[model samples]
Target: MAGIFIFSEDSALAKQLLTPALELKASLAQPITAITLSESDAEELAKLGADKVVVLTGGTWAEGFAEAIYSQISKAEGSILLVGGTLRGKHVAAYVAAKLNAGMTTDAKALKIANGKLLATRVLYAGLAVCEEEVALPAVATIRARTFLAPAPAPAAGVVETQSAEADSRITISEVIPTGDKGVDITAATKLVAVGRGFRRKEDLKLAEDLAGVLKAELACTRGIAEDEHWLPIERYIGISGQTVKPELYVAAGLSGQVQHMVGCRESKVIVAINTDERAPIFEAADYGIVGDMYEVLPLLTAALRK
Candidate 1:
């Protein structure tokens, strides 16, 4: 049987990866394991249907970590690997696959094990099309974010093992400059309030911010809102080729809800749209929509929510 490995740097990602991996594993009739950086995290991962949790102590590019996992693959003789499509996860998956000389499928929306081999589906042409891929050389696959929800009740107890790997000394990260406000990590937030081009001036963002504060949501922006007018940082953009999110709720203000933008947030459970144009495409995906001037509606909504 193939061993499906889910890689996580933090508990939240573990929360995201484990459930979907477990669901996919059950669907494929494969065994699932989680790999993390800490035992505490491993313990948490086990609750999400992981049959085992392996903890590795090493930073990025630590060849030792890869070597340790390679050793585990040798022992487990597992044929299938699963990883998140995040920058770090994708990078590590590629490196590991190369080191193992395994076939790799990236940004796989779905994957299945058939006839003891891996079959994966990936998007093409900016989601205009999907292509099916078959991996013959013992595959490594990165799962797309927001594709599945976390499983309920967790899985049975799982074993935790601490492992050590050799560190790669070739490159070192000297500093990390995070984007957005010091407190904002929109992609990780449970709720997001995004603004778009229909908003007239940069000063109007205060209204959106107030709504976000009332809703206890993070602030995001469309590509035009962020890049064209500089109303928000480029990092805040949510659309095709940008950060994809599956927030519990997403409230978009003055956004047209273009296909590029909707692709990123389609998995959001509840979408609320506010735009003056009743014909805007955003209303198609919105669970609730309000047609009126954002300047008037935002303050009212924020005040109502605060009450």
Candidate 2:
């Protein structure tokens, strides 16, 4: 029992955090506890290796969410806490860490027990360099999505603990306006098609959409596509300032593969680049490449997939 508290609003994200939580547990010989507020099924978390599940039932905002989790932390259940690096996760972590005055870091990619201390690896200087730091105990961090793979479930039942506490709401939810088609969570996508500046115009996104359809992959875009052209929503943007994705198969089309954009997708299993510039940075990171215009390659690629 590494005494690590892993938290997330959704089960899927919670499960992803469990992988590292379980690792710390096994290495430190302590219990791995998971916390969630969502009504979604989280049994998989236990099966995947959470020794105890803390079912927090309360408010939706940070204040409510923090109080519930903080209550457990106050009990000294875990000195080390891990949360997803999503916008919400960052806030919750910041709130909890601030209240406890514990060491905190976000966008962490690696964590390990070093010299009897928790050493975390993180990117700095705009993803130009990696650095490691040892944090004090009772620390909290937000792990970037796709930074760690979901490990297999251990053969044990994680005990369910419903610990409730009074929560003060800080932010009120008036209405929820969902975006994207079918509410697809790109962070969980196994296959993705990323569009870039190669497209002549926003209307040309249909080609990428067509390819995504045949591949059954999520559609993602670089910062330019989303911010400048407004071809895609900000949520669909992939980069350092955007969402990070680690799909099994990532196809980059019309993208020069700038370092910023590549930071988000570098963890992908296999990357395929399609651009007219052979010397494009994306090709260097890709496993395969086609030095040609995306407009010409996308159609042929989609046609081939159907056969």
Candidate 3:
């Protein structure tokens, strides 16, 4: 049966897409199928309103992951395929889209259905404008995390179809490194408290750290703080030269709000800038601005927010 398909080994991301997938299913009278590695998460997908779950395994992510997915969907009729837009995930989506001759939209912030096709809204020109386009049937799109809230679990469980995929002997995983061993992945953080080069010394990071603890936000930093000053891990860096984050709330302290830094955080739902310089560019882009020294303001904020 023709159905909506979501490709992600990440259960949380799969669950997030369920809300929209179920919405589309209801309107089109189609089913929702989640393709992932077979496990308890497959059963959980059913609770999230998926009608069927395909569990695939037997290869390192790059080795057989893409091949297994393509082998299964190559026979399907008109259907929709959605995936997370992580760097590697982009490779997989691009490969499949090219093979199927399907249109695709990458880094889409929003997705909906209209005229029986997928309509996606994406940021363009460094978040200066929005681009909306309709993708044809048998199309694919890579969705950004935090773009959609995870759907609530449904009472009825869907069926699980286990499929064995042999590893692609031609492809091999060269090596693996643990990213978390470095530091927090700022990209996945919903709330972020980022510091900049305003701190005279790296030791002053404690001020921002305290604020982060109280706010329960991931501690992030500008390129100078992480790269030059070495106050935080490289993974915690956010900028055009670092990582991009779209947190719901971004509390930036001491940052001048340069274009390079703003490009990374322009998608944040709310930006709160705390800086002593009244003319700082950060104030122009922030939803809320405070013209005060972060050293004093952060301490006051921490004391007030402390439990």
Question: On residues 1-307, what C-alpha lDDT tens digit does candidate 1 reach at each position?
Answer: 3677777554665667776567667766667778777667777677767888888876654333655666666577666777767777777788778867899988887777666667888866665567998897468887766655666646377788877665665667688776766766678899999999878888889999899998889889888887789888877889876878889999999999988888788779999999999999999889999999888999999999988
Instruction: Provide the lowest-lDDT 10-residue window in model 1.
Output: 59-68
Give the C-alpha lDDT of model 2.
0.82
Candidate 3 lDDT by residue in tens digits, 1-307: 3778877766677788787677777767877778887577898888778888988866547425776777667765537888866666678788888877889988777777889778888766655567897898777888766668888878888988888787668766678876653555678889999999888888898999899898889898898988888778888888765778989999999999887788789889999999999999999999998999999999999899895
Deviation in angstroms for 205 in model 3?
3.1
Scored by lDDT, the top model is 2
What ranges in model 2 sit over 4 Å off?
39-48, 145-158, 183-192, 206-218, 247-249, 274-279, 288-307
Tell how far residue 253 is off in model 2, in angstroms: 2.9
Winner by lDDT between candidate 3 and candidate 2: 2
Candidate with better lDDT, 1 vs 2: 2
Cα deviation in Å at residue 217, candidate 3? Answer: 5.8
Instruction: Tell me the tens digit of each residue's lDDT in model 2 across 106-142.
Output: 7777888777667889887657678997887778988
What are the TM-scores, per candidate, against the unseen true structure?
0.71, 0.79, 0.79
